[model samples]
Target chain A: MAYRSTPLRIDRDHALRERILECALSRVADGGFAALTMQALAEDVGIATGSLYRHFRSKGELAADVFASASQREVDALGAALRGPGDPAQRLAAGVHQFAARAWHSRRLAFALIAEPVDPEVDEQRLLYREAYAELFSELLEEGRKAGVFQLHSPSLIAACLVGAIAEALVGPLSPPARAAREAGYPAPALDDVSQGLVLFCLRAVGVKELV
Target chain B: MAYRSTPLRIDRDHALRERILECALSRVADGGFAALTMQALAEDVGIATGSLYRHFRSKGELAADVFASASQREVDALGAALRGPGDPAQRLAAGVHQFAARAWHSRRLAFALIAEPVDPEVDEQRLLYREAYAELFSELLEEGRKAGVFQLHSPSLIAACLVGAIAEALVGPLSPPARAAREAGYPAPALDDVSQGLVLFCLRAVGVKELV
Candidate 1:
């Protein structure tokens, strides 16, 4: 006899999948992609190794999904800020500031998402998310250009430059050496200083006439 | 008995050391630092493994030295362009154009030096070389600021932004996927377009009143 699906079983399955993803994200956050192993993930989720395969086809697939989920959150946050209520210049400034603050607060996860060396699966996801970010900026840039708020030819290329600048500036400070220095009494750059500078630079790069 | 040093032997040793470094660099350029093993290097250089050790203390030291040497060349090239005969803005524009052109011509070596992940020893050198690049830009920015050719605070920070922008823009086109796309009949951005856009963005970011 064929068994019919039950709502309770469906709910249980969904909850288990969420729990597994949460565990995987935490593992990556704490120890980078290197820390993620199928065996370790199964143990963390209190499941047999064989059962874990039912959820994820392979480690690369699992890592890529985790990367995409994390990156999507960042893209969403940036989108909200950039599309929020304000003039184009002000919105851009606010977006930059928010992005910097979020990355600063979670340096490890930020580094992992932004610049960590990972397997090809995750790297492919990274390339896609980078384009996602540029696409968001591109939309705003097009609007600003139409409104005469920005002067530029290639919105997408300029967007990539802004993303690159933000990543580079933050990566240095968020790197292990810089963290160690701060731990050993070397003062880190204040959040305000970096955010303000980043916003100003990005605005100018996009050819915003009036300073925000 | 302490043997007197002979000039011929010294020259031969120097040449061998150079050969080892050259081989190591080529290996890195071809397959990144992961491909750079002492045994592989010795084989490429046509030397015994024991002889290779006599020249360098360890693989890490050898790798670090190769990284430094390669990076120093880039730093020197950038310095010359920025410090060449021109106004502050012109020199900066010229420097950026030259840098982009050079990196475009040698994508593999550029990728190896700029973004390749490696062991801690090489990473440390990467940080130092990045600072070296920043120092050169800082000097030029200071000159520009004093001459009223540009308006920006924190030359070093701004310098970091420029470096990041250039690296990001080029890395995308230089990436394996982008190359594959080009091979598959996709057109790459013309060098003139990229160089011009990059120069314009950089100039504006520095607050140049009259863009080049």
Candidate 2:
């Protein structure tokens, strides 16, 4: 019973940190990263701004922590798509489709984080974030190559392109218009068709034939 | 004589605007956009801050004007690439390679512009900027398609991905160590190789069996 007290105290600290992060997210979502300030976050969390330093050493550290958390959620989504039952082509398409849908929905937050460097300190986490997406595409390409379902010169290079391209799909010319069109009396498709076409283009670049 | 006087005055005004922009670029190159202020720019250009407003309505206006001018250099670059003689494949590679190099070299200013939306009035220019890049890419792809060099669902979509990927390539990851690895002795290939691969991937995506 006494040993249980240690875990409970740790949980309390965790809970408080989570509360601050949640408030930060709401602010960041409403306004871009330009609005995220430690003072504002602390006020929202009902703590002295000094209390924030105990959890995060600096504003960059706090932003990094929050970004890491957001990135992990992104990684988890890719993992689900990767783990879901399907063939290499099917899995890849489904994975990209699901990601595009979700990312397009979170465009404001994603654009703020991806377009600008938050903290140069969290760069590794960003790579981890990229690596997670890379792995999903890599495994699909590798599996397809092994099974003779795909022909590729370099699985790794192609995987990198897919990861980069698919992520780009959620932001650029297509995304902004897609968003506007979605809101302006157009029915939202279950998947982003243009994004799907881009993914298929990569698959075909690897010589995957007969893939829709 | 009176008609000539108005034209000369307009030309002088244009020249002054150009001088201010040139000074702004030099200052931004030395520091970064975040450090650029109306006051500092006024001093740097030998004009009083109040006089500066005669050329640019506000700091936001100045930045937008500066960006509009800098972005024109890219447009000129695009025109130069188009005017030179090459097949669709060669032109496509040349265009992307130059874009990558330009992006890598002017990364500081480019990062500032691409990573943030300007004040609302200027923000509309961002869409037009992206469209220009898209149109440039579309021109190459269309040339390729016309010559039976490229085939795809949409040449426009592929071009956006290529341009977007190139921009994303210039940005550092959220992790500082990885960026250090890139600068230090990492085995990663130079960005030139990535640029080459990107163009090659695009050709392959469009059903080109071999690059010309």
Worst 10 residues of 1 chain B by lDDT: B115-124
Candidate 1 lDDT, tens digit per residue, B147-175? 99989987878888888788777767777
TM-score for each model:
0.79, 0.68
lDDT per residue for candidate 2 within B1-212, as digits (tens), equals 45564888999989989999999877665555556788898898898899888888887677777777777788789767754678877777777678767766765666555543234333445545766877787777888888887776667777666655555444432123434677797865466666666667766776776765
lDDT for each of the candidates?
0.85, 0.69
Per-residue accuracy of model 1 over A84-135 as CA lDDT, tens digit each? 9998889989999999999898888887787665655675676678778888
Model 1, position B128, has a per-residue lDDT of 74
Which segments of candidate 1 are over 4 A away from where they belong? A1-20, A27-66, A116-125, A181-186, B1-17, B27-44, B47-68, B115-128
Per-residue lDDT value at A51 in model 2: 95
Please report how far candidate 1 places residue A105 from its true position, in Å: 1.8
Worst lDDT 10-window in candidate 2 chain B: B170-179
- Which candidate's DockQ is highest? 1
